[model samples]
Target chain A: MLIDQIKTIINGENVSIALFFIGMYGLCARRNILKTIISMSILQASLVLYFLSLSFHPLNVPPIGADLNAYAYVADPVPQALMITAVVVGISVTAVSLTMFVSMFHKYGTTNWNKVKKKRGEIE
Target chain B: MRRRVLAVLMCIVCFVVIIASNKVPTSDDLPIATYITKNAFAETGASNAVTATYLFYRYYDTLFEALMLLFSIIAVIYMSIHEGDKYDE
Candidate 1:
């Protein structure tokens, strides 16, 4: 019961943070270049989630009502707005990274990090 | 052995994150947020406070974001074009 209450009290940020670490692990531990790119996108998504979560409250309306005073609770709009740009940038970055990976796969003939390094004469 | 070590380290990092995130108060109570919510409709003539903030207060950031996307698109095109050329040869 105590643990459940604590879970209820835990901030939404905890979920985002966990996602971040999952992404980080994938980025560090994965060998495939595509998987690494996927991990990077996952990290970006977690950041977006964190920002969106920052704007939430238990019973808040969307910040779109004409009668501003009618609503006792409204979510923070700044984080929501900021995250829109972040999401766009994340998409752009992922697209570009994937394109680069395609180029690299063509050049090196392999997606595995160690194999690519060996083929390219890079020290691991 | 290396994976076990990394897993332990990751667990420690996750614990630190939980502790740090727990300390941050989870409430929408900032004074600036209050001001934005109250006056955004009047200042920007938009019912949506988030839209007003992005389109008016921080429009420059949005402009740069667009430019960044544009450049990335150009880069991808150029990179793929060279690959095509190499294939023809």
Candidate 2:
């Protein structure tokens, strides 16, 4: 009952925040470069979720009806629209970063951050 | 040992962030959302508010985002091709 009350009050934003923290934990704790990139994408997704939840209302309909008065309570579309751009940017960034990671892995033969550092030191 | 300590620290930081985020301002009272919803169809002739917002109010941003995506793809292709060439030599 208490948890339900908290859920009602916090709603989906809490879940998004939890996802953000989970991604943050992965970023900090993982040693592999690929894992870090995955965590960054997770962080981006959580941010998108947070923005999307902001656009929601309890009884709101999608903001795409011909009869405006009939759908008086439409969710805010600004955040949702902006987040689409952000999502595209996130995808591009992930793609580029993964390419870089693959290049680095090819050069050094390892994905672990510490091992890569050691390899760079040996080369230098 | 250091990883465990860092994990505990990260957990503490996350809890602080969650508590702080609880006080974020509500969006209900914002006039902008109402304005966009009310005027979207009249100005943009699009029933979908999100599409209207993207194509009308923020088309420049969309254009730049497209450019960015294209540039990043080009960079990836260029980098990979040069790396491949290096292996052949």
Candidate 3:
């Protein structure tokens, strides 16, 4: 009954924080360039989640149409606005990184960082 | 092995620090948010509050964001299409 009262098993913040760590693990432990890109995306998503959660409030209404609901409080617009930029920037970054990775993979025929490094050395 | 262990340790430390540095979130709005809530539509002429805040309140940010998008598109197209040195052929 006590657990039933808890609507969510884990808080959204905790989930995002955990995802942040998982992304970090992928960045640190993995060697593949593509995997690194995926990890970076995970990292971005986690940050987006964190900020959106920071400003999130359910009872608050949208800051529009005062005649519709004059009594309702407006939700904080700052985080939501900022997160839009963040999401776009994240997509842009991922696109750029993928393009770079594609060229590197084409040149080196491998995705592992160490292998790419060795190939570059041989080229020089 | 050592690197993985270090990463786990570092992440755990950061996680604990973040959780400890803040208290639970309150439903009340921050003082700075009052400006956006009260005057967003009046100042920006937009019914959407988020649109007003980003476009008018933080126009500089929007400008830079547009640049970032443009640069990324250019970079992807150039890198993918341009005939550069081919080493693996």
Candidate 4:
């Protein structure tokens, strides 16, 4: 029952809202660039979960070959199609952001944003 | 000191608001479990709805996402390695 409840929650809008807040918390709370990147990844995963949940329909047979008329449910294909694109884009964005974080760490010798900013000012 | 106290009070109020809003679900809300179970297999060819949603319909997106994660790892490693080389020089 708990699993079912969780499934329901994921399928609904709450997961997306939760992820958005959590991601914001990570971005705002963490001083380390790596943690921020990890948080961003988590945020992206939330969206993936949200989109994937939309494709479900109870008691439906796989779309391979079934009695369409007798079937009690039909799956939503559009969300599934859209989620694939979201996953890929999320990955690319995470990759680029992390790359920038790593480069910043290298240049400043510290991952803390405040220190990095100070160091950049010194360099200029 | 006044600003710090105000900030703490604000944080507590926000926390309380979030907690209060998460009430028990009513019966009228849509039964997502039933919906998922009914449509999952018929819409996507996967037995598992989660798998079907992620791998089948969104396979290309998943593929690119994995690639992007790989790219991040590579970039981090590259930057660190380059930083080390610069130190040696």
**What Cα-based lDDT does every candidate model obtain?**
0.82, 0.83, 0.81, 0.63
Regarding TM-score, does 1 or 4 come out ahead? Answer: 1
Q: Write the per-residue lDDT of candidate 1 for residues A30-95, one digit (tens) a residue.
A: 788898999899899889988888767789888896767678888888888889999999888888
Pick the winner on DockQ between candidates 2 and 3. Answer: 2
- Among all candidates shown, the one with the greatest lDDT: 2
**Chain B TM-score, one value per candidate, order as shown:** 0.69, 0.75, 0.69, 0.53
lDDT of 1 at A47: 93
lDDT for A18 in candidate 4 is 64
**Ranking of models by TM-score:** 2, 1, 3, 4
Candidate 3 stretches with Cα past 4 Å from truth are A1-9, A67-69, A122-124, B24-29, B82-89
| lDDT over C-alpha atoms for residue B54 of model 2 | 88
Residue lDDT tens for model 1, B1-89: 69746965885688686756676665546787788889898887999888888998889988999999999899878676663365543
- Tens digits of per-residue lDDT, candidate 3, B17-83, equal 8766657657574776787777766766787778888888888999999998998998888888646
Q: DockQ (C-alpha) of model 2? A: 0.65
Candidate whose TM-score is highest: 2
TM-score of chain A of each: 0.91, 0.90, 0.84, 0.75
User: Residue A115 lDDT in model 1?
Assistant: 97
Q: Show the lowest summed lDDT stretch of 10 residues, model 2 chain A.
A: A65-74
CAPRI accuracy category, model 3: medium
Interface Cα RMSD, each model = 1.7, 1.5, 2.3, 6.6
For candidate 4, the docking band is: incorrect
* Residue-level lDDT tens digits of model 4 in B41-88: 777656656566567645776776777678767765655555336554
lDDT of 2 by residue, A14-57 (tens): 77888888888888788989889999999999999998987577
Error of 1 at B2 (Å): 1.9
Q: Per-residue alpha-carbon lDDT of model 2 for B8-61, expressed as tens digits?
A: 698678767776778867756657778888888888788888898888888998
